[model samples]
Target chain A: MNTKSDILIIDDDKDMVETVGTVLEMHGYAVRKAYNGKDGLSQIEKKIPDLIVLDVMMSTDTEGFDVAYKLKNHELHRYIPILMMTSFPKYMAEKGVEKFQHILGENWPVTEFLEKPVDPDDLIAFIKELLDEKNP
Target chain B: MDQGHQLIKDQLFFRKELMERIDWFILLRWIAVALGLTGTWTAYFIGYPIAIWPISTILLFCAFYNALFFFTWRHYRLFRSDDIEYYIIFAHIQVSLDFLSLFAIIFFTGGFFSPILLFIFFHILLTGILLSPASCYTYSVVVLAAMGIMILLHITQILPPRPPLFQNITLPSSGSLFDILSLYAIFSVTIIVTAYLITSLKVSLRTKGRELLRVSKELDASIIKLKALYGMVKEMHTCTDLRTLTDSATKNAAIIMGVKACSIKLLDDQRRKLDFVSAYGLSEDYTKKGPIDIGKSPVNLRIVKGDRFSIGCIDEKEAFQYPEDIEKENISSLICLPLRVEKMIIGVFCIYSGTPAFFSSEDVDFFSLMADLTAIGIENIRNQENKAWFVKKASHQLRAPLNAAFSMLDLLEKGYHGPVDPRQKEILLRCKARIKLLGEMVGDLLKIGIKRANMKMSALFDVDVKKKLREVATFYETRATEKNIRFQLQIDESVPTIRTDPQLLDHIFSNLISNAIKYTPAGGSVSVQLSMDNKKYIVFDISDTGIGIPDSDLSNIFTEFYRSENAKECTEQGTGLGLVIVKEALDGLNGSITVESRIGKGARFTSRFPVPV
Candidate 1:
C-alpha cells in the first residue's frame, strides 16, 4: 500500500488539472486527475483522495459546486478537505462578506476559497494547511 | 392646467339637465290641455249653465298654442340640441303664452271662481327654475296686472262673463263680494312672496352647482397631471440616456403648466452661458436662438444666481434679455424659474405664454414643485449613470465558457499552477471544461468588444417588427402630446416579417424612434413608416422635424458614445451609445440604415433588412 497522501485535482480546464497534478507530484504527494464533476465523483468511488482541488466554473458555471457538495457529503470521503477556486475574485473575497453570502451561501460546501490565477506557492501553502487541519 | 377647457363641458351637462326639465314642462302642458278639453265637454254634457261653445273654443285655442310649442321643442331637440341660449328664449315665450291662455280662461269663466286659476302658482315656481331671478320677478308683476285687468272687467261689466264653476249647485254658504275680494288680495300677496323665495333659492342652488362642477373639474385635472408626472419620472428612471429622458420630461412640464411653451436651459459655469437643453411648445426658430450668455443677460443671470424672475410683457424689456428673439418667436409673457439641487443652482426652467401676465403666483408655485423634483431626478440620474458601468463590465467579463479538459497539456504550461509560475499558473488554473471557452473569449470574442458587442448571442427568435413598432409608437405618443407634436406610424400591407432576434430588432426600433423624439422640438412631428414588397429589404423610415445632424457630426454619430456638439448644447447628459448599439445589431442581422438631414430642418433614418431566404 502506498504511504503518501493521495490528492485529486478535478477541473474543467485541462491545463489547470495537469499543472496541479504536476505540482503535487513534485511535492511528493500521489495525485489523480479528473476533468469534470462526473469523472471526479467516479474517481472518488474508486479510491477517495485525502484532498481535492476544485474549480467553480466547469462544464456549467456551478458544476464545481456540485462536485464539492458530493465529496463533502460522501460517507467515505466526507473528511477530505476541498479547496474551491473561482475566476471571479470579487465574489470569493473574504472582505466582500455580503457578496460571499449572496453567491456561496452561509455554509460553504468546501473547506476554503481561493481566487483564480493563483500563485503556486500560495496554493501549496493553503493545501498544506488544509491537510494538516484534517490530519490533526 | 386649471382644467379651463372642462368648464365648457360642465356647462353642457348643466344645459342637458335644463333641457330635460323643459321636456317635462312640455309634457305637463299637454296634460293640462287634455284636462281642459275634457272638463269643458263634461260640464257641457251635464247641462251646467256654462256656455260650451265659448269654453270649447278657448280650450281648442290653448291646444293650438301648445301644439306650436311642441313643434318648437321637437325641432330644438333633434336639430340644435346644444342651442342653450335659444332654448332659454323659447322657454320664456312658452311660459308667457301659457300665462296668457290661463288668464284668458279665468277672464272668460267666473272672475273669482275660475277652474284653472291655481295653475298660476305652478307658473311662479316654474319661472324660478327656468328663468333668471329678474325675469321671475317680472313674471309676478304680469300675474298681478292680469288680476287687476280681470277686476276692472268685473266692475265695468265689459262684454260678458261665464258663470261660476259651481253656480248651478245649491251651496249653503256662498262667498260674499267682500270675502272674494279679500281672497284675491291674499292670492296676489302670496304670488309675490313665493316668487321672491324661489328666486333666492334658485340663485343659491345654481351657485352651489357651479362651484361643485369647478371643484370636481380641478380635482380631475390635478389627478391626471399628477399621474402623468409620476409616470414620466418612473419612465425617466428606466431610461439610461439623458437626452431622451429630458426631452420627454420637458415636454411633460410644458403640458403640466398648460402653457404655450416651456424650455429647460442648463448652465455652463465655465462658459458663463445658459444653453437650452430641452423645450416643449417653443418654436424651433426660438430654440435655435443659441445660448444666453449670463454676462449679457441680467434676468437669466439673476436666475442662474438663484433668483426667480419673470417678464410680464416681453416687449417691455424689463426682465427680458433678448427682445429680438422674443419678438421673433411671438412670445408675450414668461416666467424664468431657477432649477436647484440642494444649494447649488444648476439651470433655468422657463414657461412662455401668448397672453401678457398669464402665469399667476399659483402657477409659479406649482411649477416650482416640478422644478424641484426634476432637479432631484437629474442629479440622481447623473450619479446612477456614473455607477452603471461596474455591473455591465462585470457581466461582459463572464463569458459562457466552453466545455473541455486536458490534465496533461495544462500541466506543461510554465510555472503552471498546482504549484508553479504565475503566467503559466494562470493558464493552468482554468478547468479543462472551461479553458477552451476562456481561450476563445480572451481570443476571438474580444475583437467585437465593449460598445458594439452582440446581444446575448444565444437568444435569437423571429421578431415581429410591425407589432413592436406600434407598441413603441403608442408609448411615445403621450410624450408627443405634451409637446404638441404629431406622431404617426404607418405600415404598408406588403411589409414582410423577417426571422431574427426580437431583442435586437426592438433595440433598433426603440433607439431610432427615441432619438427622433429627442431631437424633435415642440410643435414638430415624428413618424415611423414600414414597407416591404418584392424588394431586397424590409424597410422602415423613421422621420422627425427636429434639429438635424451637422455634416461633420453625422460621420461620427455611429462611433461608440459619440454625441454631437449641438446635441450636447440641447442636453447636458447623453450616453451616446444608442446609434452604435443599433448599428451593431443591424450589422448582426445583415441590415443597413442611412440618415438624411439638413441642419435646423429635420431628419429621416431609412433602415433596410435583407429578406431571409
Candidate 2:
C-alpha cells in the first residue's frame, strides 16, 4: 500500500473510463485517461505509467489490441504491468484469452484479466496486490 | 388370295364400263357427222327435193356437239370441285345431256319411234345405279317429260310431218304403250336401290370418321400431358428454391389434371403442424386460416392413415366428422399425396375438384409421382439453406471470442502488470501473431457468409486505391524487410478513385500482401501494381517471388474447404479461405482474378475490375 501506483485507462467509453478512474483514484492510485489508442500511446511515450488498464473495444473494436501489440513490441514500454478488461461473453473471453496467450504467452507482461462490469473493490485489490508485488 | 383376286376383278369391270361409255359417245358423234354430210350430199347429187333432210342433218350435228361440250364441261368441273355434291351435280348434268341428244337423233330421223330412242332407257338405268336416289329420280322425271313432248309433237304434226328418214325399214310391231310401261317400271326400281345403297354407305363412313377423330384428339391430349410431365421433371432437376418448386408443382398439377385447385402443405421443423406453402385456386379466407394441425385435420389424418394415397368426397362424407369447412369451401373432391424424402413424409399435396368423385386411382398415382419428385427437390434446397445458416451462425458466434482474445492480447502487449522478461515478450509477440491469424480466418468466414446470403457491405464510398495500397504496403514493409525481402508498390497516377467497401478493400490487400511476405524467402521481392487497362478497367497485379503454388492446386485454390498440398506443407496457419473470400468479394464487384504460377517460380495474381461508368 505504501508503493505508489500510476494507472493509465485507455477506452472510448467516457462513462466506463470515468467510473473505473474514480474507483482507482479513491484507492489512492494516480489515474490517467486516453479516449483512444493513439492518444493512449502518446501518453505512454511521455510518461510510462506503472500499470495500464485497457478496454478492448475502443475507437474500433480491435484498437485496444493494436495499441497493446505496439507497446509490448516496443523495447522501451515492453515491461509495464498491463490488465485487460472486456465485457464479451465467456466463449468470446476464452477465445480472446487463447489469442492473447498465443501472442503474449503464459507469462505476458500483463498482470491479469478483469471481465466487466468490473467489481470496483476487486479492481482496487488487484491493483494494490500488483503494486505491493512490484515493491516487494 | 380370293379377296385379292375379287378386288382385281371388280376394278377390271369398272374400267371396262368406263371405256364402253367413252366408246359409245364417240361413235354417236361420228355417226351424226356422217349422217349430216351424207344427207347434204344426197340432196345435191340425187337432186332430191328434200330440203328437210339437210336441215334435219344439221340439227343432228348441233345436237351431237352440244352433248359433247356439256359432258366435257361437266367432267372438268367435277375434277375442279372434287366435292361430293359437285360430283352429284355433274352426274345429273351428264344424264340430262344424254337424254337431250337421244331426242334430237330421233327427231332428225323424222319419227318418234327411232331405234336410237331405246338408248334413253339404258341411260336412265345407268344414272339410277351410278348416282344417288335423288339424282336418279330427277333424271327419271326429265326423261318422262321428254318422252311426252316427243309423243305430243308426233301426234300434232309439229316434228315435220314427212316420211321417216329410214323409209326402207319396216315399222316396229311393238306398241308405244309397252315402251312407256317398261321405262316407268325401270325408273321405279332404280330409285329404290340407289336410295338404300347411298344411305347405308354415308352412315357407315360418318360413324368411322367420328371414331377416328375422337381417337386422334385423345392421343393429342396425352402427348400434351407427357410433354408437361417432361418439362416438370426438368424443372425439378434444376430447381434450387423450395418455394418456387412447390408453387410450380401446384400450378402445373392443377392445369394438367383439370382440377379446380391444388395446394401443398409442409410440416415445419417441429413436424407437429402443417403449413400451406403454395396454393393454386384456394380462397383467401381458407389461406388466412394459416397452418393446420396434421392430426386434427381429417384430410391429413387420412393421408397419414393410408399407406399409398387417399381420396375423399366432400358430399358423401359425414359433415361433422370431416368438418363442414371443406364443404363450405366448395372442395367436393380431394386427392392427398404424401411428399416423401428418404422414407420420411415432409409434406402433402392436395388437389380439389369441384365435382364429386373427380379423382380416380390413376390420378392419385400420377400425383404421387409428382409429389415424390417435389419432395426430393425440397429436401435438397432445405439442406443447402441449413448449411448456409449454420455458416452464418458459426461465424457470428466466433466473433465474440475473437474480440475478447484480441483485447486480452492488447492488454498483455501494453504491460498492465509487472515488467515482462524477454522470453515472455517473445511469447506475447507470437500470441499476437496467432490471434491475428484467427482474426483473419473469422473475417474470411464472415465474408463468405455475406457472399452466400447476397448481403451487401454496410459501408460503400469512393476510396483512392493507390493510397490504400501504399498504406497496407507500408504497414507490412518492415515485416518483409525483416526477412530480407523487398515489398514494393507500383501505382498508376491515372487510376481514379474507386467506389468500394473500404474495410473489405483493406482486408483484401492485407491478405494478399501478408501471404506474399509469408511465402517469399529472403532476397526475394513482392510487388503490388495497380493500373487502368485500355478498357477502363482497374487491374491489380500482385506478384511475389515466393514459393509458388504447384500446377495441380491452381484450379482448386479458390474453392472453399480446399487447401493446396503445397500451401499446407508450407504454412499451417491459414483457414484456406483467403482466396475464396477474395473471389467472392471480387464477384460482388463484378471483378475477376487470374493467377499464373509455376512450382519453383513466383506467383502473380491479377485482379480486374470495371470502372463505374
Candidate 3:
C-alpha cells in the first residue's frame, strides 16, 4: 500500500486542479484529480483521500458543495476533510450570520474556505497540516 | 355662534326652525279669529248675550302680531338672516304680545272667572317651547300678574266684570273670595306646570343640537386633516428631489394648518446651529435672518431635542428670541414640532399664524403627524443615498483585487519571475485565460450592481450613438478575430445622436457585442445595424451566425444565471449574466429588446429606444 498521504481535487477548471495538484505533489503528498463532482465521488469511493480540495463554482455552480456533502455523509469517507475555494469572497461573506454558523459551527462538514489563485506555498502547507491531523 | 361665520350657520338653522313655528302660529291665529267670529254670532243667534267686542279686539290683535312676525321674518331674510339676535328679540316681542292678547280676551269675556283664562296657559306653553326658560318664566309671571290685577280690580269694583252669557260658562261660585282664591291657585299651578314641562323639553333638545353641532365640526376637521395627510403622503413619492421635498412640505403645512407661513429648520452639519432649509409665505428678509444658533436659542434647541412647544402670543413675550422679528412680520402664534425618525431628532417643523391663539391642540396634533411623515421621507432619501454610496465603495474595493489578480497572472505568463518550458507555458496560458474570464465576469457583475444603484443619480448627456457603437466594435474586434469570426457595423446617417448616460450607453453596446462574439463559433459572422425607425425610435439589430437558442429556453434568455443547454455545451466560461445586465441597462434607457432564433440556424436581437426630444 502507498504510505503517502493522498488528496483528492474536485474542480471543473482543469488548470486550477493541475496547479494545486502539482504544488501538493511537490510537497510529498500523492494528489488525485477529478474534473467534476460525479467523478470525484466515484474516485473517492474507490479509495478515500485524507482531504478533498473543492471548488465552490464548477460545471454547475455548487457542484463542489454537493460532492463535499456526499463524501462527508458517506460511511466510508466520513473522516475526510474538505477545503473549499471560491472566486467570490464577497458573495460568500454576504450570505450573513446563518451561513457563517453553518460554515464555522461544530458540526460543519467543510474544513475551511480560501480565495482562488491561492499562493502555491500556502496550498502545500494546508494540505500537509490537514493530512498530519487526520493521520494522528 | 361665537364668531361671525359661526353665527351665519347657526342663524340659518334658527331661521328654518323659526319659519316652521311661525307657520304653525299663523294658522292658529286664523283659526282663533274664525272661532271668535262664528262663536259670537252663534251666541247672539242662540239668545246668549256675550261680550263680542273684547274677543274681536283680541283676535284682531293676534292677527296683527302674526302678520307682523311673518313680515318681519321675510324682511330679516332680505336684510341678511345672519343677524340672529334680531330674530330672538322679535320672537320675544311676539311672545309678550301673545300674553297681552290672552289677558285682554280673558278680562273682557269674564275676567279671571272665564274658562278662556286657560288659553293664557297655552300662550305660556308656546313661549316656553320657543324661548329660553328665563324668558318663558318672565312671560309666565306677566300673565299671572295680569290675572291677579284683573281679579283685584273686579273685586274692588274698579273694572266691571262681564256676566257669563253661555249657560256652560261657570265661574267657581260666581267670584266669591274663596272661589277667587281657588281659581287663582288652579290657574297659576296649571300655567306654571305647563311652562316648566315645555322649558325642560326645550332645554334637552338644545343640548342634543349643540352636541350634534360639536361632533359634526370635529368630524369635518378630522376629514380635512386626513385628506391633507393623504395628499402629502402621495406627493412624497414624486418628490425625489430633496429640495423639492422640503419646499413642498412647508407649502403643504401652511395650507393644511391655515397658517400665515411655514418653515423647516434642519440642524447644520456640526449640529450647533439650525439652518432654515425651506420657507413658504415668509418674506425674504425673515427667511434670510435665520440659521439660528441652537446654543443661543433655548426654545429652538428644546425643539431640536425632541420637545414640542408653542407660543400663543409671540409678541407678548419680552425675552423671546425673534420677538422683534416676528412682531414686525405680524406673526402672533408660533408652533414648533420636532421632526423625528424613530428616536433621532433631525430638525424642527415650524408654523406661524398672524392671529393669536390660532394653533389649537388639534392643529398641533395634525402638525405632529405631518412632521413625522416628513422625517420618514428624509430618512428614506438618506438611506437611498447611503445605499448608492455603499455600492460604489464596495465595487471599487472588489475591482481592485480582481484587477490585481489579472495583472499578476499576466506577469506570470510573461515569465517575469522565470523561464518556462512548453508544458509549463501551456498551463500558464490556461491559467491566464481562466483569470481573464473571471476578471471580465466580475467586471460585468459589478457594472450591473453599480448601474442599479445609480438609477436615480445617473446624469444624462448628449451621446453620439454611432461613435459609441463603433468604439465598442473596435474594442471587440480582436476577440472576434481570435475565433476567426467576422464583425460588421452599419450605421444609418439618419439615426441622429441621442441624449443618454454615456457610461450606460457604453455598457449597453459592449455587452451586446461581446455576447455576440462570445456565443458565435469560429468562422461565424456578427453584424450590427443601427437606424431610425418610424422617426420616433432608434432601432438596433444585432445578428449572430452561431448556435441559436432553443424555443423552450428563449423566455429565460434575460434571466440572470440562466444559460441554455447549447450555450453550456459550446462554452464552459460563460457566467450566464451578460444578457441580464444588457437587458437591465436597456430598461434604464427606456428601451426594449426582442430576439428571433432557430436551432443551429442563428440568432438575431433587435432593440428600439425612443428618440429623446
Give the number of the best model, judged by lDDT.
Answer: 3
**Residue B133 Cα positional deviation in candidate 3, in Å, after optimal superposition:** 5.5
Off by over 4 Å in 1: A1-136, B1-14, B33-57, B60-78, B113-115, B166-189, B227-231, B234-238, B267-275, B280-332, B338-346, B388-613
Q: Report the Cα lDDT for residue B596, model 1.
A: 91
Q: Flag the better candidate by TM-score, 1 or 3.
A: 3
Greater-lDDT candidate between 1 and 2? 1
Deviation of model 1 at B460, angstroms: 16
DockQ of each: 0.10, 0.03, 0.03
The residue-by-residue lDDT of candidate 1 on B228-273, one tens digit each, is: 7787787666554455557767888877777788888888858498
Best by DockQ: 1
- TM-score of chain B alone in model 2: 0.54
Better of 1 and 3 by lDDT: 3
Compared with the true structure, what per-residue lDDT tens digits does model 3 show for residues B332-371?
8889999898998888899999998887887888899999
Give the poorly placed runs of model 3, Cα more than 4 Å off: A1-136, B23-111, B132-212, B268-270, B284-293, B312-333, B354-365, B392-548, B561-613
In every candidate, what fraction of the native interface contacts is reproduced? 0.23, 0.00, 0.00
Q: Which parts of model 2 are misplaced by more than 4 Å?
A: A1-136, B1-183, B258-260, B268-272, B307-313, B316-332, B341-344, B354-365, B383-429, B435-573, B576-595, B598-601, B605-613
Query: Residue B529 in candidate 2 has what lDDT?
Result: 91
Winner on DockQ (1 vs 2): 1
